[model samples]
Target chain A: MTAVRPPEADLVVADTAVQPSAPPVPPAATAVRPRARPRPAAPRRILMKGNEAMAEAAIRAGCDAYFGYPITPQAELLEWMARRMPEEGRAFVQAESELGAINMAYGAAAAGARVLVSSSSPGISLMAEAMSYMAGAEVPVVLINVMRGGPGLGSIGPSQADYFQAVKGHGHGDYRTPVLAPSSINEAVELVADAFELAERYRTPVMILVDGILGQAMEPVSASFRMPERRGAEWVLGGADGRPPRVVKSLHLKPEALEQHNLDLQAKFGRIEAREVRWAGERLDDADLVIVAYGTSARVARTAVARAREAGLAVGLFRPITLWPFPTAALADLAARVRGFLVVELSAGQMVEDVRLAVSGRRPVTFRGRMGGMVPTPGEVVDAIRELDGLAAGGSR
Target chain B: MERSVIFAGFGGQGILFAGKVLARAAMDEGLEVFWIPSYGPEMRGGTASSTVIIGDGPIGSPIVDQADAAVVLNPPSHAKYASHVAPGGLLVVNETLVLEPTGRTDITELRIPCTRLARDAGDDSLVSVVALGALVGRLRLVRVESARQAIRDTVGMKRPQVLAADLAAFASGYRVGSRTHGPSPDQEIVRTRVHHRVGVPR
Candidate 1:
């Protein structure tokens, strides 16, 4: 790469140097009165598929634009947007490809519009480059990955194999996308509604990761949402009427300048990791083994934990709602008291690596996973827990 | 309390629709519910199924290895799911289509001629709805009134023309299920005959 530094590099350094150190204001606390718009009054409670509910929640969250290419499991989301986005007087485009869709999202988000882009495993892989660009540019964009089995065009069945691809960074460079995993349609809706706020607050991409099961599953959800207040972003690209033109780009040919940008990204990731780790626990206080899981696997593990409890086993479930920052501190704290840990996933083992890092050999972390779209049933997980119980009781690996 | 049901049949048998109806009814009755379908590249003759879980508390694991109840509308579905029902649970089979016996006696099995009943009720496509009514009639998973309301909300809103026929089919199945009991003395004789023919131990 050529080492010629653009003159705008100084302006970029000045812009990022002043990032606020204050903790982000929670979205609900900063909300204003609902906007006056004529639309159908949301039903108090209605049954909806996870894909459809998430799409609806994005609209309620004031997503100003949507760009996506249809893919299995998540195609319904794009289809829903196609019908509803225009009804709300918003922009919706069925881009020619995932690359095009993600770039459209990048452009829309850079212009200060709340944007949503969605795809499945292979589709997401196609968008990885643009994702890196958006993260580097520090533009707010919300992405939904309704994951399916995959290394490559794997299967259209539910899979969490993208754990590494999501939390560990799918694209190049040192960057982290805040990942929210939802096990149920209701939770998916709530997370989708909040994802926009999270992205805007951090000025980075936020991913809502679900699996095909959740996307296709139907459940009762309250469509009503507290609409987030819209505010003008200072960094967005508008006409350079009286002010100097702002540059939003990821290209930095000079090594030192690129290093500075990377450091800024790392610092922003640090703040996110410190402030945005979210998890849910059940029966963890007195448990000997905590089953660590997220998304659909977590739902199955919850049932397994409950069954193990009924069988008089001291078992609990720890579900990480945010896959990254990976709930490291919280899990480390648990590792101190719990005898061992059992990690479950819909892949051979991806998140288990993170759990191992979090536990740091303090407690043995055993793993149970299924690949190629086969989900571990609650009984299977319970069986795994029984094995872990024996190992924990024996005080052996 | 938590209960789960699996609805399985050939495609176009309204397998998913039946499960949705139960889930919707459960929701209307103020219970938490989940309905997940087996989705893939399948056409009209292929196997299709959906699982619905209803609970008083938060539901975990929408898919289950063994459901509390199952409604199987075709022979292949019956062969696949008959043993998948939990012990002491209910299995509602479409008698007109499922020729083989379930070969199990631990759980109450209702073999209603759902297709015949639906045909008599003026819509053969209501087979799944009839089986659904039979399931609710035996299990009492949700009130019959609530199920009726759910049909109005789900199927009625979609295909309003068939609403009356669907309701009628549901009533016919309900009547059959209410009058039937676990392996009537006559059915026991039939089960023994079937076991002997199928070479299955009683």
Candidate 2:
């Protein structure tokens, strides 16, 4: 729950200086509540930060193990699973370094175990080379970048500054990877489950791009879930499948072979975009303004729409849960109904440019966002809504 | 229906644990619930608080900007959260810790010596539960049986000496609350925590 070692918690466990003893009360301290009135089982509930939710959703999506190094904003994901994954019969280990975690993810994915690696920007920078290796080898490992403010060791404040690194493909070569940008706790849960499926289908690395705000903010989520079942690893290069040995390695001195590999990867991404492109929509029907955003900024947009409605303005919201596939098709359709595109985010118009590319001048696209961990509020979005309405009055969106 | 309460106090007041127990009790009732705590600087002697939200509907926005009810353990909390309570909300304040009245006319408030109540019950650590008792008595949001079970689930019958005293302290709290006001909410928050008689993996 983004606990920074509260004083009360410290008092409860102050002796961590020494090794933590087995709990004073054994598991027996947890008593059994009788099933009264036989109601339907309660959905799981947790007051958890978004990063913890991502790790949990990863586990629920059949993550067999987690390979990660501790970093601010995202440290909770590792800490949560450290005690929890083993209880779920999964392996949770803190890698010696970000490089080690990324390589471990590569190995786990190659072995067909649902595996994940997560970090903030600085930590992610260290693993970019390994990420490329994973993509080059066609392994389906999920990597989460819970972004903090920065170009380097930015304070653990929220920022969408990693847009270029995530969507543009930070690693070398002409290869591309799929990225999912979840805006809310609910989407964070659903997107990771969907991400694992997409990764397996594409047989490529998938990035779940999250900001520090989403990483640290606590939200309510259903507590009980059955992780998706593990499936088809028949082709994984794990030495023996009782058949011919297939090795999974990223190595190519031959230019022709590497070019072919890139082509195959591109074909995979194209199929995914045509078939994928996940998004969340709101009040876009017969609207004069469409607010396009993702992650935490999108939530603020939702609140702004409510305020705009109260102010007698017609505004709708669109959140692209999947970033790489871009959801241009959905935005294009929304553009048909709305007067203009107002892209709001925590960075300097990264997603707004994508909105423009998608709308392709069919509608006027504009942006109002913050940088370096600053967040735009609902009032800011309301202003944008009013400005867009005024712009439409002049026969332009 | 969703019933949420915020528990706040200085460090060592067991307010956060109180919140967790409330959430756990709500869970035992087969209700969806969450226990969220405020993070303090990684140091000793820091103040802490937690918000536990229990509901039948999908709970939205875990951070409650305005609380329908609260259990405050310090004077500062009384000052901080007093105005944020919805009109006619239930307020359970620690008589031993909070020396001032919120002096609000619209809300129903019950003052109790929860710290003294817990200390008399042989565990000053249980003051949070004393506050919880008052909460349950005043609101009846959760069943009495559920409250008892929550206690047993949290600290079993093994400590038979404290078990009865803990239950009695809860009774004192509930009684104090009932004596102060009647149930006013249109819908009661029925909590349901899911647990196996034999332990299964959480």
| Top model number, TM-score | 1
RMSD of each: 10.9, 11.1
lDDT of 1 by residue, A1-397 (tens): 3321111111111011101122211112121121222134423457788998898888877899999999998988998888888877899999998999999999989999999999999999999999899999999999999999998999999999998898888799889999999877777877886788889888999999999999999987753443577766888997789999999999999999999999999999999988887887767777878999988998898788877877898887888888887888888988888888999999999999999999999888899999988999999999999888888778854
lDDT winner among the candidates? 1
Flag regions of model 1 displaced more than 4 Å.
A1-43, B185-202
lDDT of 2 by residue, A209-324 (tens): 98876676555554333356567766697776568888787797799987887788788878987877677666665467888887777766766776687799878777787788
Error of 1 at A45 (Å): 2.0
Query: Lowest lDDT 10-mer window, candidate 1 chain A?
Result: A9-18
Question: Taking the tens digit of each residue's C-alpha lDDT, what string does model 1 give over B1-202?
Answer: 4688999998988899889888888877666788999999878898899999887666788669888899999988888899999999889999889988888989888987778777777777888988888888777888888889889987765678888888887777776666568865464444334323322111
lDDT for A77 (candidate 2): 87
- The DockQ value obtained for model 1 is 0.24
What is the TM-score (0 to 1) of chain A in model 1?
Answer: 0.88
